[model samples]
Target: MTQLPSAAPTIATEPGQTEPAFRLVAVAIEARILSGDIQPGDTLPSETNLAETLGVNRSTVREAIRALEQNGFVRRETGRKKLFAAVPQSRDISRRLKTAMVLDHVTFEELWEAMFALEPAAARSAAQRRTDDDLAALDANLAQMRLALHDSDVLTDLDIAFHHLVALATGNRAIQAARLPISELFYPPFLAVISRLNAAERLLFAHEKIVEAIRDQDSRQAQDWMEKHIQDFQRGYELANLDMGTPAALPRAGHDKQ
Candidate 1:
């Protein structure tokens, strides 16, 4: 057999040899979005146009778009149609943070302590600042929780929504944003405990009490009640035979990298 020429060895570049062109483009586009040059619901320039405008390869532009999409800077319309600008949703950011916490094996005590620090404050503020719409939202979530007591999926969603509404009722966007991830992780265990203990009635009563305190604008009562309610969940977790020391479970696939 004839001898073949040896293939060239691939050279491994060091860090910062050259920044990825797509990353640079992503940063530039993200700046535009943050500066309000591209508002939510506005369509991004077409891929071809973006490539030309950014003086990069079309593939690079596509990569940049993918990064933005993953980070919640933009999203596709229904049916995977045209991409549009989007405000970075608190929920999306929270999901990513929760995934990280789970993957890193965050302790239940740490999680609970964080919740204790925030939830009571949120309750107090919500009591003082809640609007009529906030009240309506809380009522709707409570009703949904009542209707879905036996349905784990529905109950879990309502529990999360209820907490989010409370955060919004505080009328502090920063607090709402900060609470989003912690709240998402916080409710699943509640649902799990409720499911095992058949404690829907108790859960509903607690929720009603919280709502009433908020409606009455009783900040101290709201704070105290919410703290007790949350601590009650920790107690239930133990009663349900769950390992409180074990870290929360990660979503099946893996952590979502933004």
Candidate 2:
């Protein structure tokens, strides 16, 4: 009977564990961060300490830390040797999203739809919550815009900035974060419309109306003007002969940021 206990059936080979050790280390740290075991601004253990605690080589720990830094999970202060934990900034995430949207060939209509929802909400909230400083910034933007109307490059940038200011005026992080990436995505085809149409005067008039509403704390008027402004943008696009059916694109290479 003992001799009849033949060798167990050979098992099929499992998939190979081919991932590098540093990735596992980085993931472990990310888990710690998400679990709140390692809070932002907390100093990370030294390389030697991590190597020993993690049972990995010092080189592996270093590589893991480097990966975390690149992903905005960790950072070192200038002239300081210690590494600090960090959460990624909204702007960094928005930049990455902008790149991804361009790569994925997202369409203009998708961006416009997103903005149509967010922009009016931002205007409505800004009217209710904006501070004196917020009004000052919007006023400054409007003044610059008045001078830049004929300059497409400056005007487009101001237009984008103007909307950003409106979102900022809302004093709502949720609104700001939701709108940031879409705003950046919203500008390329927008510039195409800007270049092809005599839209600046109309654009400035709408901005002035929206600003006046915000100044007067009239949420309804603010939302109404902003919605009309966005609608005017669509109309300008139609008049420009640009095809809305086309996928979104990166700004033409020489164009400045808008």
Model number with the top TM-score: 2
lDDT of 2: 0.81
Which residue ranges in model 1 land beyond 4 Å of their true spot?
A: 1-17, 76-83, 140-158, 198-201, 240-242, 251-258
Minimum summed lDDT over a 10-residue window in model 1 is located at: 2-11
- For residues 106-212, what per-residue lDDT tens digits would candidate 1 score against the true structure? 87767777888899899999999999999999998888888887887777677777877898899988787777776666677657666678777777788899999
lDDT of 2 by residue, 1-258 (tens): 011101112111214746677777777777777777778998887877777666667898799889998888988989667888888777887777777787788888888888999999999999999999999999999999999888988888899889989999999999899888788778755865775687789889999999999999999999999999998877788888777667776555325232
Q: TM-scores of the models, in the given order?
A: 0.77, 0.84
What lDDT does candidate 2 reach at residue 194? 71
- 30: Cα error in model 2, Å: 2.6
